[model samples]
Every structure is written in structure tokens, then in C-alpha cells.
Target: MTGTTWDILLLGGASGIGKSRAAARLAAGTDGFIVEFDDVVSAVQAITTAEHHPALHHFDHAPDTARLTNDQVLALQIATAQALEPAVLGVVRNRLTVDTPALIEGDYLTPAAAARAVDDGQAAGRRVRAAFLHEDEPEQIAANYATREPDDGDQTERADVSARYSHWLAQQARTYALPVVPCRPWDTLPARIREAVD
Candidate 1:
């Protein structure tokens, strides 16, 4: 609890890192509303001129990035995430005006953006907490994905992207002085996130 506008617990990390699960666990014991980054991005895509927005690629027909280089994939994802930042902040702003706190969980909630939100007073609360979770090992991350979607044919690509993004996120969190939680499959990750938020 550090800010004065609204209480927000921003969970950011790579895919398959259990952010949504962590947020759900956090919400169970707290009066917090859940806002998925995908939902906001999807809603925005539905209303806006998505054709012109690079971030809206998740909607409609997405380009097959299987053949693209790793850097290209990262660039595409980062662009989309950056584009979703405003909408995420909008959701945060709206939720703040209400009485309930919010648990915003997503890969798109970059450390830089979270820090900006706090510094800009958008996350005004006595408990403005933000952290990044990651499974450093690509094989472990791929294993996590397998459990979620057993038919995933792009496991290798997904794992690579997750590893790269997770590394970047961890560094970003450290750079911003935010908590960095290692969410290894065997760990009690939700508890770690709870500790970070508390």
C-alpha cells in the first residue's frame, strides 16, 4: 500500500507463468476485481479500427509467425502489448473510481508501464503492488504449456518466446525495483505473489 488513487496488484510475466491463477488466488482472500488484459484488448479491437492497430493482431486472422525470426515474434508481441497499455490503464482508472480494488494480470502489463502507472498516480492506493513472475527454464515453461494445451504444436516457438520475454521481464522488474517471483512449477507461486502484494 503506497499510492492514493486506487489499490492495484499488477501481475506481469511471460505466458504459461500462472499469472491468472495467481490473481484468482489473490482475489479469493481480497476484495479485488479481475481484469484480464486479453479482455480489454479484445473489447478495444471490437470497437476500434483494428485494421490500423498492430496490437489487434490477436483478433481476426493473425499472421503465421512460425516462419518468422525470434526477433520478429518478440517485436510483434511487444507492439501489441504496448498498444494494450492504454486500455489496461483505462480499465484500471475506471475500476479505481469504484469501491473494489483490481487484480490486473497479463503479460502485457510491462514493468515500465506499471511503474509509469504508479508514478503517474493512476495506481493510487495504500497498497499499490506490482510484480513479474517467470519460469526461467524454457523446458519447464514448455511443460507448463503442454498441461494447458496438450495439442500445442508450436510448443518450441512458444517456449522460446516465453523464455526471452520472461528474461526481459525479470530484468525490467529488477530495473524498476519491483518484485521478481520465480514461479517454478513446484513452488507455491500464489503464496509468493501474495507476499509480494502484501
Candidate 2:
């Protein structure tokens, strides 16, 4: 095992629930490292572009691409996961050199994957914890989504996604026995996250 010691803290919940914002605060306050899933997506997009094959070109815009079927998007997600696994392992193994925690923020990591990450970190003598953030109001989430630009890649027209994800996260929290941190007024999310991490 690598000599570096770290903790894997995952921030997952409904979209626009302030997962990324909380992660940034955690990193700043604790002098820890942050690994954001969107950055991983961007890197995967860049790698797909470098390969530049017709079959892989569909990944350029991913789920947003109108030409690709649902099956194709699923395939791309699988491929990206496979490609990222090694890099993630490497980062966990070699990049972290301090005892500070590592925060991984994403809504996409499955329950199984998150459990595996925690197990792996424990096996390496590092502490790990997973938290799910939730917001009670659907209208609040809708307002957040509405603020995004029309051309923003992360834009979603359907506010149901946020509500659906909140329900899904709630179930996951119960199933996994993870802490459910309720966030509101978005501005105070950072303090909430700090308290959770503490």
C-alpha cells in the first residue's frame, strides 16, 4: 500500500443541492483534495475526442446528443467508468500524500460503487464516510435549474429530475445507513457540510 494516508468523503444527493459547493468548502477548510465527477466527465470527453473514432464520437456530447440512443448513452457511461477506474485508483494510491481527507462529489456513483470505495479506503488504513444532501422543496430546485443558461451543458428542462433524485437519495440513505444532511437557503450549505464533515 502507498504510504500516503487519506479519507474518502463522498457528497452525493439531488442535483443543485449544493454537493459541489459543499465539497469546495470542505477542501478549503480542511486542506483536503476534491475530486468532482463533472471534471471526470470533462476529462473523459477530452479523451474521447483524442481517440476520434466514429463509434466513440457519440460520447462527445454524451446524453445530450440527440442522435445517440439510450443504449448508446449507457454504453458510453460504462466505457467512461471503465476508463476512469484505473485513474481513480492511481489517485487514491499515489496522489494523496497527507493525512487530510479526500472529498469526492458526485450524484452518479452507485450505492455499490460507493461502498466499494469506502471498503478500499479502509483496507488502505484510511477513514471514509458518505453523506447524502437533500432539499425539501422542489420549487427551490426548479429555481436553481431555471437560472442556468439555455446552452449550458448541464441544463435540464425537467425539474422532476431533481425531485426524483431526492427520493432516490433518501432511499439510498436509509438503505446504506448514511447520514442525510438537509440543506436549504443554499448559502448556508457550506456550514452544513463543514458540520457534517466534523
- Give lDDT per model, in order: 0.74, 0.60
Tens digits of per-residue lDDT, candidate 2, 135-156, equal 7776767667766434554433
Alpha-carbon runs more than 4 Å astray in model 1: 1-6, 55-63, 121-126, 185-187
Clashes of each: 8, 0
- RMSD in order of candidates: 3.4, 5.7
Query: Lowest summed lDDT over 10 consecutive residues: which window, candidate 1?
Result: 1-10
Among the numbered candidates, top TM-score falls to: 1
